[model samples]
Target: MYKIAPRISQLTVRQVEQFRSASAWVNPSRSRTESGPEASIDAEKLFINPEVQQLLVELTGMDLEGKVFRARRTTMQQRSHFALMTDERLSETMDKMRREAQRFLSFIPLKEPRSEEVTILSKDDDIKAFDNSKFVFTDITFDATDQDRTVVVREVDGTLRTATPEEHDRMNRVYYEKPNRPVFPPPVFKDPYLQDALARKEHEFVLDWACWFYEPDDPAYVNLVQCVCDRTVDNNDFEVLHSTRHFATLVFYLALNGNIPPLLNYFGGQGRIRDCANLVRLQKRLLPNWRFAISTSDTDLKIVTDFVKQNSRFHEALKDLIAFLKDGVILSRASPKVGSSFSAKAVPKVHISSLLISAFYS
Candidate 1:
């Protein structure tokens, strides 16, 4: 008999919420079913799994998991103004973009000026109006009471309109009420995890903003590169580097944020020769087809040679460098394609020095 391994399934945050809602409906005992003292008593006995509890706390912004319940509220307002030098050129460009958008919208005949509504069974029903158009549609209520479900639509300005009933009754079923998730009032940062995630997102946003504002070869690009280098150096985890999938992902993110230089610098840096050699050895073992540049620069070679001559203990470094150079030469000859194919198959078994050598060659 063959043994079957349990498969891991990943769920999206929204799906997880739906799962929780469904769980509440399915397992009535897990939720408060009654009113008054009985509900409170039942709630005390209903134990939530730690993971679900954490997710609920995150989603609701109420720390009601376990004994640590912290209520937090936050509100944000942003305002900015730019004073132009009364230049007609800038104004003209702005007007042109607006007019272009308007003209593009005019091609779509969906803009019914009269206050009216049109119920749509599915997105396909609105396909005719998909062309650029400025129209307001609102007051959508899904009617779940009827066997032939339908969406009741009303214009925001109060005109009512009805559409043909949908054949699918499931479409009208209310999956769950949108939770009135607690909104932090003002001047408050949420949980540390949330704060960290938000900060990271903001940093990425700023990097994108800068990239769009400046040319690719701008000095800002160099700064961005340096910043990534700093982060790589600071958070140099050898274990993560050893995993090709993990390392590639990290590199991809850094590259996407326009910070590849730091990664290059870290790989080529003289300080981590042993680590680099190990990395190179590992890469060669895992991805034999992939070629990496090992620094054969006179300055680096001479430095290695001098260090070996002065310190007997550093002879290992010389050996690693040689191995790295050998791998680089092989890769160069092979011209192994860059990216994942090279990473996954080539068993990474080289020493840190090999990585350094590969970086130099690169």
Candidate 2:
């Protein structure tokens, strides 16, 4: 009873190229300063991002915004314990701290399924003869399933550990051949080949291959999807991710990392007001303090309007969303049905947000 995991690429509907770059894209404000390569990498001002501020403001409430001053009665108390920092310097320091915190949060990993146990085969004294190439061994017993098979690797430095999920997949492919699954990962997963594939708008293809070839938690797979998903978001290639599963993956990654506002804007620009509403709802559910159980009877418009009423900062970053809703109301003289065809049910109800929050500590 062998079953193959469906390729995300083959399952996806290739999007028709639309001239979306010409459209004014309303996105979270980012400050960019001319410096060097590092500056470009750190250009995103996460502290100023409305979504980040929204979550922080909710969680901290008045503490984040309130300032406390101590009244000094004694002369000793009145004497400053330390030199006072100027407002400009204090602001810069706060921004630096926030950036560091944001960077740390983004790198945090989510919960992954259990990995195979590793068995050590070599010892310190016996490993000196080996070269740099690590040897990976796989158990191919008739009773062993590809997933449950034992795969171990002996490092060149004499450390023996379980094969990484990527290595295990490669070993499995080597022992039990599967069409399109290569023993060695395709060069397309790397450098110029990846760039070329992205340029040709083969994002789905790349994503499918990456998922098929590597475990979902594999670093390479994660990096590849981030690149592909970011490009798809930037280019407004929404049609390229037609599969509900693939779309859910995109949403999970973006919402997990707090980088989903731009995707909402894309939906708004495409006149997908329903989508914008659902996305906002999804974002709210991902926040620790905001995960109140949503009523199944709540309409999309109600969900969005409730959020808009409470969140003043979204007026700017979600300008497209606001305008889209307004236009639909005026034109249709009815509740907008845009993007309703793609139901929120497309997203899995597996407590993905909970997993993300737990992963922050793990």
Candidate 3:
């Protein structure tokens, strides 16, 4: 006789919890029930993965060697302001970017959410009557918004707690089915299909759809996005991202995992030295104890040098980056300002990049 798998509903309480724990990757740092905008950073699944580190090294080498630098398909105001606008506009853009970056980096909460005590169901006579199955209850009131809907679950062991995002979504679909959301998750979110979509450069499409389909805090959403993000790093396909929205999120994810060297290399290769410095500033902001010497007066080039010298991770691609920075300095000095209104004779002394320095310092 062939062995058969037991149905999930028939599993014992401890067995069910074990299976859930095994299948779902929960962020231990946050509440399992709370929903929020920020996705959990799974360090083990990302930077700690051997494949990911190898890919980062490869991308850094390519970028530092000037082999992967190309004109971006889309324009980013903050990155393009130096060539596209007057000094005043450039300064304003940089200031806005700096404030935004600071806000994003400063909100790191190390404290996890406090777990709530379970409320026993009053309807259960002995409390052991329905111990064999988990019961879920949802607020079906007409005015209840899906996002604000109250969904709770009573586990097989008689423990009552707020339903997880996945469970909450399921309950919402059952009561108020949206035309776009399916009863079950789409197959595209898994395995070969996701890899195929990423390879085709449909990252933006996939991410947009994921935002629409799953709540920001949904485990499915988090997993899908991070998987896509890891692939982007692996392929060094930043250009395919097309806009600043997801790009900033990607940068934040990298910084969260202490992996910014490849991103630095990419910016340096693209001749965006200010962007490189901004990235280093972001790193320092995230890690307060970084102990790097930086000030408003320090050139962006110097800031990048500080990162390279202190972080041993930068050793592998150091020579190429240094050479690129040197060439950038020389080229900036020799070439006339391409789009600035200033006369050739009135051009200010050249820095490593056309980046506005004061904003990053702030």
The candidate that achieves the highest TM-score relative to the unseen native structure: 3
lDDT of 2 at 14: 24
Clashes of 1: 42
Candidate 3 residue spans exceeding 4 A from truth = 1-135, 154-161, 317-320, 328-362
Candidate 1 lDDT? 0.30
- Among all windows of 10 consecutive residues in model 3, the one with the lowest summed lDDT is 107-116
Distance (Å) between predicted and true CA of 88, model 3? 19
* Most accurate candidate by lDDT: 3
lDDT of 2 by residue, 13-44 (tens): 12111211211111123211111012111112
Question: Could you give candidate 3's per-residue lDDT for residues 1-362 as a string of tens digits?
Answer: 01212222233334323322221223233221113212433333443445443333323322211212234344563353236788999799767765554332321111111112232323333575565788887879898787667677776665555666678788988888887688778777887888887777667667766766777546667667767877887766665552323554566566554566666765655565676777666645543445566797987778876666565546564433554554442112211122322111222333544342332222
Q: lDDT of each structure? A: 0.30, 0.50, 0.53
Show the lowest summed lDDT stretch of 10 residues, model 2. 31-40
- Per residue, candidate 1 scores C-alpha lDDT tens digits across 45-114 of 1213243223222211111221111122226544444666467877886676555533322210111011
Task: Look at candidate 1 and tell me the lDDT of residue 127.
Answer: 43
Best-first order by lDDT: 3, 2, 1
